[model samples]
Target: MPEETAKQTHFYSVEAPDGSYDLRIEEMLARIESTAAPIYMRLINGKIPEHQDKMDMAQFLAVMVVRTPGSRKDAAEMVGRMIQIRNYATGVHDRAFNSLVHRIEQGEGRQLTEESRTSLRRSLIDPSGYRLELGKEWALQHLTAADKLTPVLFQMRWRTIGAAQGFFITSDDPVVRWVEPKTWHPIYGDHGYLNKTAVVTFPLTPKVMLAMSWEDEGANAFAGRQGVDRLNRLRALQADEYLYAHLDHEVIRRMAVATKGSRPRMTTEGFGPKKFAATTLRRGRANRPS
Candidate 1:
């Protein structure tokens, strides 16, 4: 367990007995089905998020592929067009930085010191929110200058968290600063990453039970359906324990059976940080700033 927080969390190891786990997963499934928000209500899942099982854990990373519009019929031409547009945007933004600095110096009635000038330049290049997707090799393989669909690539970092409030896990960045990294990392490769093997985790918070399926293929892998969900919270356990001991625990039973398979992960890096398999990506709903 990561350092105990004010909210003390108990550990639930995947290596524990399978017989006991079956019944426990059932109870968790029952709790979530009756309490979690519906799929049509996903817009609000960000606030309350979704509940997850104790073992619903894996490290996730992602990148994007965007199709572009053109008639030149060559991959290079398509890439060139994108570069032109990006450069134009960068130039415009750089000018705005100069203007802001000019105003600050004028308003203060003093020229910017050398150190201040360096700081201003650094701030101009820092990522505003999430970093822009920048891989062109993958894009070139799927596109040509003649293709009208332009795919842009944005990479997502592998994130760890204490508890899953919902269906997705936010990265260890400035955005979701509350999540803590806790896991048994047998998968860490020589590069010191969790991208090598599948990991099971014990989330401190409850997680929703949802099914994920692919709706598109190839460059359209990002498209998928987020199924309905259920939660497994400590409070839910208490409420249901007394009410109905055996009243329809099928939902949870089914979920436990399904989870024994491989974890669903999303990433552009095929196989993993080390090519564990010849594959790439998983399905989930991720938020991006408009």
Candidate 2:
């Protein structure tokens, strides 16, 4: 490690060696996994998790939400946006000037003074130029977010459901937040973690799933083939990149094909006067699944 990095006190103490923070995060996650392991086994064996077990499981899921590659991607993008804003605030105008010049050359058909160009370029600058490659330092932010989200997850009504037929498929980004079609809106897109209609779901295994919702309708139920298929479709729609299952089946292929054009997407948009907003829609959740 560089002398400066060695002295930085953030994720791990200054006295700790380089990579200590990463190991610490891994060990923390491992501890949560170990705690949740028995709960998972109980659910798999057709037992309802105790209240304390539920809280442990909720913490496991909450931390899982922040630890995935998809979450890291979102965090990196957020940092890029913040850097762009910082640059703009600090009067870094080179990118904006280049963007304005390119637009003028591309026949925007506007005549403008240098002052006009200077003012207009701010709106035309490409945010991608400010992107950053984040490192393990981001683990602190993830841990804090996970800590805050645990209670919200614990407060929700949880259900441990079994699939009567067919299997559940999970993905690289697997924790899924879904809203009823009736409550969905084009602009809002309806996957907000706090949305009253939103139900967060995770497949515990090929035959069982854990679902948390604000509603009380579906607790501890067995989903039939149709229900299982519906849940699988949600998994397909929400997958970040890859899917996993115990068995290789044609259903997976079919799902991949069916949801190809409509996969969930997480994006940042409204780059101009509106500024950038991180939006999580059915096409994407901010953090991915287990």
Against the reference, the lDDT scores of all candidates come to 0.28, 0.68
**Candidate 1, which ten residues in sequence have the lowest lDDT sum?**
57-66
Over 4 Å off in model 1, which ranges?
A: 1-5, 8-94, 106-109, 126-290
lDDT string, candidate 1, 149-238, tens digits: 111101111222212222322111101111113533336522212222222221222232221111211221111123213222221221
In terms of lDDT, the poorest run of 10 residues in model 2 is 281-290
Candidate 2 residues 203-247, lDDT tens each?
A: 988888988888886558898999998888887786666778898
| Cα-based TM-score, every candidate | 0.20, 0.70
Cand. 2 Cα-lDDT: 0.68
**Best candidate according to TM-score:** 2
